[model samples]
Target: MAEITLVEAVNQALAREMSDNKNVLVLGEDVGIDGGVFRATAGLLDKFGDERVLDTPLSETLIGGVSIGMAAQGLIPVAEIQFMGFACSTIDQILNHAARIRNRTRGRLTCPMVLRAPFGGGIRAPEHHSESTEALFAHIPGLRVVIPSSPERAYGLLLASIRNPDPVVFLEPKRIYRLVKQEVPDNGEALPLDVCFIIRPGNDVTIVTWGAMTHDSLVAADKLAEQGISAEVIDVATLKPLDIETISVSVEKTGRCVIVHEAPLSGGWGAEISARLAEHNLFNLLAPIKRVTGYDTVMPLFRLEDQYMPSTDRIVGAVNEVLKFE
Candidate 1:
């Protein structure tokens, strides 16, 4: 029960799963020799050996294809793409094959693979490294998109994803890789998927967010609390099969909602949550739903990077605006 960062928790989960399940394997660029771009797979090579941990050439598309093949053949391959920007090439294999394998084979084959990538901005990385295009994967019917906000959830949710019998996109928030630490037990237990975790309970407003944005959202909630505003915060662990029920119940009680995300605002996952709330919890709302998100533009360089991402001030502003309606 040592305190660990989010990235360390991820490594613990992978090691535990690979040790318990011989079929679990890890493959990706620099995953074996170098451990990984961010070293999320650090020290796994010695522990699991080359057969279980492979370092593939720098080709995301190849990694995706190979992982799918291994999965169909009964191996649980946890493939990693160094960065989310590089993962774009894997869309062909992921969308057309991995996602549809089980349905296409009519249950004869199930693609049990976990595609891992470090996503989101805040590290001031160059172009492409800061992409937060989770909505793209979430739109794919057969895929499950999961993003963890803290070390505990990262450890638990990743275990669940690896054990799942379907293809899962496990997007790690690189921004918060070492932002904070939590006492995470290496118990091999997993958190349930397709559900939301209400990290903070309140009654005035519901602040919905995931990934790195969860950090800022929680900060905003604290700021609101000082002002006598009790803001509930929901960490949407699984985005695709969204646990709207948890969100709806929170909104129903709070009667106000503010969705947050690092992705550009036009069609980010926040929009999907907003739509679901409006459709089902319209009458319960006291104020119009608001979204505090990134602008509809490319993630800028270091100078403008902080400005582009949603901030605690912005979240509080949105909550205040919604509160004004009441």
Candidate 2:
């Protein structure tokens, strides 16, 4: 295992998958010569050349549309939208076509493709550059949504997504792209989907989260210890087919739950989680599940953006509220 950044892990996964599968192809705006917006695709184009690692026009609608056609025809096409917000442009293709392709074909044709995007705020990127849109994709019947919290999980899950027969929306946490680092397996790592990682083990409260919010959740857990609360932080690697068993175990032990995310409070993934907890463990609950999430407003511009993103203070406050219920 070697210490690496999220960007490095993503590049390594792409490189290894392409080497193993001749049919694996990558395409997106600035992906080929420019190495992608975050350089996650850097050096891939040079290795695979223009045909395999393509740089398409700046039209997400066409990118998803074309990738669907390629995947249906047997090419494992991985299309990257510039950002999660830009992915909205491809909804027509994704919702009406890519997602429904295999079902529409009744198992004859498969949309075994991966839609990749860097999502969520924290690097002070421009508006529309960071959005946690995973829930939207998860709500689609035939689509799989995944968001890896660290370098190792990123590499493992990317490989899994590429190998899956169904369509996948792979969301990378943009905030920790270059900011966080960890030791990642060089190769030969196959992490299964539908599993959750207990990033930190504790007994007081369970903090469930994914993407960049996982990093903040851990920091908040550490602070909570200073205040005499032992918080368990669960880093969710897959968004769809959520590891409810793992979450239920932690929540059952802790008797309190605080969910964290960068998306707005309304209609976000947190709502789904909260509903699940209420359904599975309401009798075991010591406190009503709380959420530390973005404001119920648009992704704010630079000026007051800090107010729109989740922070350690916000997370701890939510946890404290749950703690009081105990």
Model 2 stretches with alpha carbons more than 4 Å out: none
Candidate 1: which stretches are off by over 4 Å?
none
- Whole-model lDDT, candidate 1? 0.95
TM-score (C-alpha, index-matched) for candidate 2? 0.97
101-143, model 2: which lDDT tens digit per residue? 8888898988989999998876777878867778888888788
Clashing pairs in 2: none
**Which lDDT value does model 1 have at 186?**
95
TM-score of each: 0.99, 0.97
lDDT of 1 by residue, 260-312 (tens): 99999988898999999989999989999999988998788868988999999
